[model samples]
Target chain A: MTSALGAGLEPTLDALRARRSGIMCKHWETVEAGLCIGEVAGVDDVVMRADLAHYACRNNRLAQLGLEQDQFAAAVGAATSRYGRRRIGVFLGTSTSGILSSEIAYRQRDPHSGALPASHDYRHTHNSYSVAAFVREYFGLQGPAFVVSTACSSSAKVFGNAWRMIAGGWIDAALVGGVDSLCLTTLYGFRSLQLVSDQPCRPFDAERNGLSIGEAAAFVLLERGDAAAPGNVLLTGVGESSDAYHMSSPHPEGLGAVEAMRAALRMAGLQPEDIDYINLHGTATPSNDAAENRAVMSVFGAATPCSSTKGHTGHTLGAAGAVEAVISALALGNELAPAGVGSTRLDPQFGVHYLFDNRSQPLRHVLSNSFGFGGSNCSLVFSGAAP
Target chain B: MNGVRLYVDGIGLHAPGMAGWSQGCEVLGGRAAFVAEVPPLAAPQALPPTERRRVGLPVRLSMAIGLEAARQAQVDVATLATVFSSTGGDCDNCHHLLDTLASPDRTVSPTRFHNSVHNAPSGYWGIATGCRLPSTTLCAYDATFCAGLTEAVSQVSQTGEACLLLAYDTAYPEPLYALRPIPHAAGIALVLAPKQSERSLARLEIVPDAGLPGRMEDAALEQLRTRVPAARGLPLLQALARQQPAEVVLEYLDAFHLRIGVMPCI
Candidate 1:
């Protein structure tokens, strides 16, 4: 995983343990919005591999960077040797994709005829499928591949898709993840919606206003867990639902969120009390946090320890699901409930147990929540392999 | 690899000269001559007036086909899960946002900003139908239709429930069009079930193959099949129209094609 928190899992764990915030007030590209952003450092300097030059863009660069870290490529190579390349699939998630390339192309359009530059490559860069295509070509895998683009819930939902494909005997394994890069469209677009925070986002804090936009690339290899190791984390359950209420606003009572959580628990054959920690989707927006709190209370109540790591990495948009999933795994492995950075005080109105400080405890099962624009909601359950 | 079997309970289609499933079958079955004229699209009446006015071509196209298939299958739209696939989502809205962002003002409309998401149609579908069921949106460039079919069928096979697959694509406006030239707007919707039912139109066994993909016989239909990503399902639709047991290969990824064995039910 590569995120604003750090480049790899160890560094991300370190930052989470230390409760360090990666968000800073900086201007990205030409836009001077004067807002806080969780920009991944050195993304502009990333160069595409020679063979994959046609897939050059900020999004692919971030994906390549994430793929190179934590010996992920080597792990995939081993999986290839075991399962063969044709038995694995690539399923990724992204929102705006490399629309920045088109945004730039639009600026460089010919004034006379309004023609775009001949060098513009929409298929490789701007297309929503580009990241998956790049990853598939990078690994030379010849299996089913697609990109899910359901806003913030995209990557989380890919887990459900991969699980179904594997369960259905179509593919033996899946490279499931998400990659979203900083683009003027999101930065300015969120700004237009008045959802961009001027300071580091304080998720679940009493004074929280809105979200701090961030960029990240997170990937996880999912295979059948029949022959799993002792300490390996296993994906137990996945639930997906739609709000059917509004486009940008979540359902007031979080009815869909409740349904998704309950469905996930039902699939896992576990009850709400089985969840040890909850990774809240808290984007720091007033309505989002409040709605999620209602959903969490209705399902798990106020007993389970929960925190939104968005305070550490900021909301990575489409990548938030995979990013937080990795974080949840890290927390389970380390048995640490990382603090919700930037949130000094919990909202008094929130009935759920919102963790404001790091707590060390024996953790077994964790639930991560990710909801997005269009009222799409997804919840995932992860548990440590039985000892 | 063994093929996965699924039943097609209903079908919806909208393209140039082919407006609905019956019309599409007529053209594909060779009972009627294929005509190449722009088709009229009406706003989905299920949506309220405010939302109805806000939607663009992609939403209208998806809603038109989705509602048609659901109505034909006699299933509650509120309970059916959906898979929406498109090469580029709302290209016109994207162009508008790009133009606005590039201008001196650099201020985008909130409605346009929200609608720019690839899942806008899926979101609107939920609102219009009041379906809290999960809906996923995906893109695989030109192979989008096949990809969506794969996902929808997999869902039906695994969950033992009906799934709706909606594949559509609209042409980009100007400068962007120069890069990726999708000629006309087209959409196809299939309501797939795990088991045969009273409304089952056909049974399909889908498997990945390396064989050459089937093509439309008519010149105009062939052009549409190649130009528009969603229309690549033309050969499959043609087989369904023939109502005879047949095997049809559809374009998937560069590595392999999807070969489906179609057996008519009625």
Candidate 2:
């Protein structure tokens, strides 16, 4: 996993432990949107592999960087040896994808005929399936592959898609994750919607105004439960739902969010009290946090420890689900609940236990929530193997 | 990981010359001559006036077929999960946004920004039907139709429920068109259920195969099949229209294609 927090899992956990914020105020690209962004460092310097050069773009570069870290590629190699290349699938998520390539290509269009440059490759870069195609080609996998682009819930819902594929005997394993890069479209687009925060976002805080946009590439190798070893984290449940309410705004009462959580619990055959920690999808937007709080309060109440790691990573948009799922896995592996940085005071109306500081505990089960534009919502449950 | 078996309870199709499922069957069944004329797409009645005005061609094309299939299946639209697949979603809107962002004043409209998401049609589907069921939007370039079929059929097989698979693509305008030259707009929707029902049109057994995919006999129809990603399901639909047990392979990822065994129920 790579994000504004750091390049890999260890650095991410270290930053979470230290409560360090990776958001910085700077001008990104040519857009003059003066808002703090959680930009992944050194993305500009990333070069694509020779064979995969055609897939070169900020998004695929980020995905390649993520694949190189934590021996993730090597792990996938080991899985390939066991399951064979054709038995595994690639399911990824991205919002803007490499639209930056198109955005830049548009700037270089021929003034006379409005033709884009010859070097521009929309199929490999700007297409919604670009990242998945890159990853599939990188690993030389020949199984089913596609990209889920339902905004924020994209990556989280990939877990469900992978689960169904595996359950339905389509693939033995899946490389499921998300990669979203910094682009002018999101920067200017969110600003247009008045959902960009000038400072680091304070999720669930009374003064919370909006979200701090971020970019990240996070991946997870999902195999059957029987393949897990002792102490290994297992994806127990995944619930997906739609608001059926609005495009940008979440349901006021979080009706869809509640259904997602409940459905996940039902799938896991566990109750709400069984969950040890909650990774809130707190984008820091006033309405989003409020609606999620209502949903969480109704489901788990105020007893469970919960925090939005977005305070450290910023909302990574489509990648937020996988990023936070990684954080939840880290929490279960290390037996600690990370702090919700940036937010100074919890909102009075929010009745849930919003963690303000890091806490150490023997965590067993954790729930990570991710909701997105177009009223898409998904929740995942991860648990440590029984001792 | 062998394959899955499900029933196609209903089908909806919209493209040049083919207006809906009955019309599509007539052309595919050779009962009617294949015409290569663009058909007018009406705004989905499910959408309110405000949303109807805001949506572009992709949304209209997808919703038009989705509603048609759901209505044909006589299922509750509010609870049926949907899978929307498109190679390029809202291409016109994307071109407009790119044009606006490249201009001197880079003020993107909020509505356009929200609608630019690949799932805009899925989101609007939820609002249109007031269905809180889970809806997934995905893309696989030209392999989108097969990918969506795999996902939707897997969902039905796993949950023992009905799922709607909506595949559609629209042309990109101007300079963008020069890059991705999709000729016309087309969409196909299939309401799949785990078990055969009174409305079952065909039973499909889908497995991955390396065999060559079937193609349209008519040159114009075959051209549509190859040019538009969503129309890749043409051969399979043709088999269903023939009302005979047949095997039809559709293009999928890499070297593998989905070999579907179609057995008509009625």
Candidate 3:
């Protein structure tokens, strides 16, 4: 993992046994609250996914705790009101943004019009920088705004980059998160992979076949140590690894997974068993679950409590890490081992502990893993205390 | 050790100009446009019938080159990580969708939409390859060649096995050509691993180059030509098969030139 790794960097894992407090959390129900878009382009003549996103983005009806994407400035405003407006930077990750817009615009094309619709500007909407621009403009942020496009690791890498930027004195405060609306590209792409289950995926289950596609957008406000160091969840460590393996295949031995996990542990200065709870990248596919199982057993043994929440909202792709990042912070705050929604029974072949159901326990530090295609692996360790 | 390295494990590409890269870098001897023959407004990128065109060429090239590099590494892909870098994304369809939207009545192709995601090819690669290892896609423009190459080398150093680094770029369509301002197209790969003294071909030497950031790219090909004149017409693909590193350089907009040092580990 250090082939191109710079110096003075470390990365790790933690165990979440199970306990209780309330900071905030995001569940499917939260997406139910209608997000009224002032104006939209096409697909309006009839109803479409982008149209109902105001209230139809989530799978379950679990209420999420974060602010709406459109209210990005309000979230920043909320943060600034408490800490006093400081230089703000923006970082976000996404699989597909405004792609729904593109789809809608295309569907409304005029045969002889000789031009596509103007509602969703192809250049602005498809460039991947639109969301970055949206957040920067909304909050009047001038520090730095970058959109990370590293497939699923996009959001986790955001935290990593922001940490470096802040440590390097590039910004005093920043807002980091991700947002990706569901689109046909994702649904069909998963279908092509044959990785998409006919139904919602059952992660870590012996009978588990594939994953369910979902959409989400989330963010978090990060600030450097300042007045009183607001006892908020502290960003602890991040580990990134590249295995140069095949475009789609992972090393059967979990070579890069081990390195990423080890790096995360090194960054946190902790051992494998030190982790309290582990949010796995269990996409429910045969290869992924088995490979991850091997990695966990080799490191933390079979006693660690592990669970995958993919059952709740499906796989959010790039936004998976960001949504799960917020979930980890909330986990530390609430001290509850979220119910592993998909898995019915653990694969007996793997001895590592699998959270069959949700449990409440004392939590400290948790490890969140988000791996992407093209052999990019990223692991994040979050703690309640400052490292 | 702090310097950068680039290698070729395999190759996957579909351009109007050519097929497979072999040793000697001669495979790229006559560079031309793959977009010109694509007709006035061709359909989005096509794939083998079995695979279909569910993925655009931008992504297809990434996966092909990525898989080819892994095959070259002679390692099981189920375990290694991947780093995919590209200058442009599945833009052909993106533009197509835009043109459709520009119509008085926007009617988009669901097929076009599905093939357009940046990760579409990645998802297909994962499902088809069945490796299940984590994958990452990055964008750094022309400099992506360096950023991605260095990143993979870092991964190999960090992991001690190998890393697959795929860099690809596709030109815009006619409409986009009329819009954007650059002539761009390419697909390249490297498998970076720990240097084996006995198998090592060449050692990569990277300095800070504060005064000559872009010099690495400027001097790479020429330096290789000077050192191995016999490779002038040698196909990049054949060279890779014979275990050779094709020297190449790229100049960045910011003058932060990146030289892809292909040291051998045969």
Candidate 4:
């Protein structure tokens, strides 16, 4: 994942362990929210190869940077060699897509004619499937590919899609992840909704105001369990539910969230106590944190340790699912439960055990939650292979 | 593992001259004529007054077709999960939002922002039906229909539950239209069951292979299929119209086309 916390898994893990946040107060070009952002630095400097120039855009650039990090591309290549390109599916998620590219084109319209610049390649760049198409071509894979754009739950749902496809024998292996880059629409749009915190986000804090909008690109390679090494992590279960209560607001009591968690637990065939740590979808917004807390408490009780990594990496919108999934996998492998930065004091009303400091312990099963604007909720369960 | 076989019990479609399943079947079977002009989409009665007014053509068409499929299948909409796929969801809403951002005012309305998410249509469906079942929204550009089919088929086989698959796309306005030119609004809905029941209309076997699907005889119908992503479901609609067993391939990934072996139970 690339954010203000630096690139790749190692630096991100180091930042999380050292309690170094990536969010910083910086004014975006046109946005005046004054809210801190978790923008990936040097994004403009990162360019695509000449052959991939057709897919050039800020979003794809971030995706390219993400692919280059942590030897993720190498892993994907190895999978391609094993499963053959035609047998590996690509399922990615994104929200704004390359709308930023369009946003730029809108400014460069012909002064009199109002025609957009000819350079705007909407099909290959701005389309919702652009990232998936680009990745498929980048890795030279010809398998079934699509993009899931259900807001923030987009990426988390990829795991479920890949799992179902593989289990049904549609594909031998799959690349499931998301890449959502920052753009004016989300920045101003969230600000217009009054959901953007002017300061760095403080999830679960008593004084928490709103979320700090961020961008991220994170992916994971999923194959048959037999192909994975003994110590590699495994995705045990995925649970999804639509709140159907509101378009932008979650259920007041988190009934949908509870259902999603319960479903995941049922799928995994594990009890609440079986979970070691939970990466909360704590976006730092008042209603979001409160609603998620109710859901977590109802499912895992106050005993299960939980924290929102948004405080560390900021809320990466559609990419949060995969970003937090990577964080959960990193925590499981490193045996370090990341603490909630910036939330020095948890809200007294929330009954869940919200962690404020890192804990060094043997983590076995971890659950990550991602809920989105349309009340779309998805929870994923990941287990350490050794344990 | 062999892919699970699914029964397509109900089909719904909205296009230029094809309004409902009956009309679509008629046109596909050469009983009714095809037109190339864009038709006005009907608003879904299932939505509340507030949502009915707020939603655009995409949501209305999706709901209209989805309800028709559910009705034909003789199942409660509340009992089924859904998978909604579109190449560009609510392009009108996006164009308006982009216009607002491009304007000097820059402040967007809460409703517009809320409706901007690609899954807004799925969210509205949930609200209208009060169904808490899983609903996923996906896109694969022009291959959206086939991708949605793959997802819905996998879901029905995995969960042993009936699912509604809706693939829809509408035209984008000027500036953006010049780039990705989708001329007309179209949608296709299907009610897929894990096992064939008394209501089953046809059976579908989805396999991975490569080949171009047979072109529609009517130049207008073929034009619609080539231009609109959702209209790629035309071949399946035609098979349903024939009321006989047929085999056809649909666009999927770059190297692979979804080979569907269709059999009409009636």
| Every model's TM-score on chain B | 0.99, 0.98, 0.67, 0.97
Q: In candidate 1, what are the lDDT values of residues A216-335, reduced to their tens digit?
A: 999999989897798889999899999999999999899999998988888899999999899999999999999999999999888989999998888899999999999999988999
**lDDT of candidate 3?**
0.55
- TM-scores for all candidates: the values are 0.99, 0.99, 0.60, 0.99
RMSD of each: 0.8, 0.8, 11.1, 1.1
Model 3 alpha-carbon drift over 4 Å, by segment:
A1-75, A78-87, A110-114, A225-230, B1-87, B93-169, B174-183, B186-266
Residues A37-142 of candidate 4: C-alpha lDDT, one tens digit per residue: 8988888889897789999999999999999999888898888888898889999989988899888888788989888998889988888999999989899988
Q: lDDT of all the models against the reference?
A: 0.92, 0.93, 0.55, 0.89
DockQ-based class of model 3 = incorrect
Q: On residues A1-387, what C-alpha lDDT tens digit does candidate 2 reach at each position?
A: 999987999999899889999988888888665768899999978989999999999999999999999999899999999998888999999998999999999999999988999999999999999999999999999889999999999999999999999998888999999999988888889989999888899999999988999999999999999868988999999999999999999999999999999999999999999998999999999999999999999999989889999989988999999999999999999988998999989999899999999999999899999999999999999999887
Model 2 agreement with the true structure over B165-226: per-residue lDDT tens digits:
99999999989888789999999999999999999999999998877888888999999999
True-vs-predicted CA distance for residue A307, candidate 4, Å: 0.4
Strongest candidate by DockQ: 2
| Stretches of candidate 4 exceeding 4 Å from the true structure | B1-3
Cα-lDDT of candidate 2: 0.93
| lDDT string, candidate 4, B22-70, tens digits | 9888889888777655567777788889888888887898998999999
Point out the higher-scoring one by lDDT: 1 or 3: 1
What clash count goes with each model?
0, 1, 103, 0
Deviation of model 3 at B256, angstroms: 17
Query: Residue by residue across A132-232, what tens digits does model 3's lDDT show?
Result: 55555545554445566766678777776566556544456778876665554555455556676755577888888877665555677777744224347
Rank all candidate structures by their DockQ, best first, as comma-separated numbers.
2, 1, 4, 3
lDDT of 1 by residue, B1-266 (tens): 68999999889999999999999899899999888887899988989999999999999999999998998898888879999999999999999999988888999999999999999999999999999998999999999999898899889988999999999999999988888899889999999999899999999999988778888888889999999999999999999999999999999998678999999999
lDDT of 3 by residue, B1-266 (tens): 14544334444433323343432233333332222221121222223444543556665566555665566556566566666665456667767765654445444565664455555555555555555454555544334455455445545654556566666666666444443323444466656555543323344433222133322122433332222211121233333334454543443223333344444455
Q: Is the docking of candidate 4 incorrect, acceptable, medium or high quality?
A: high
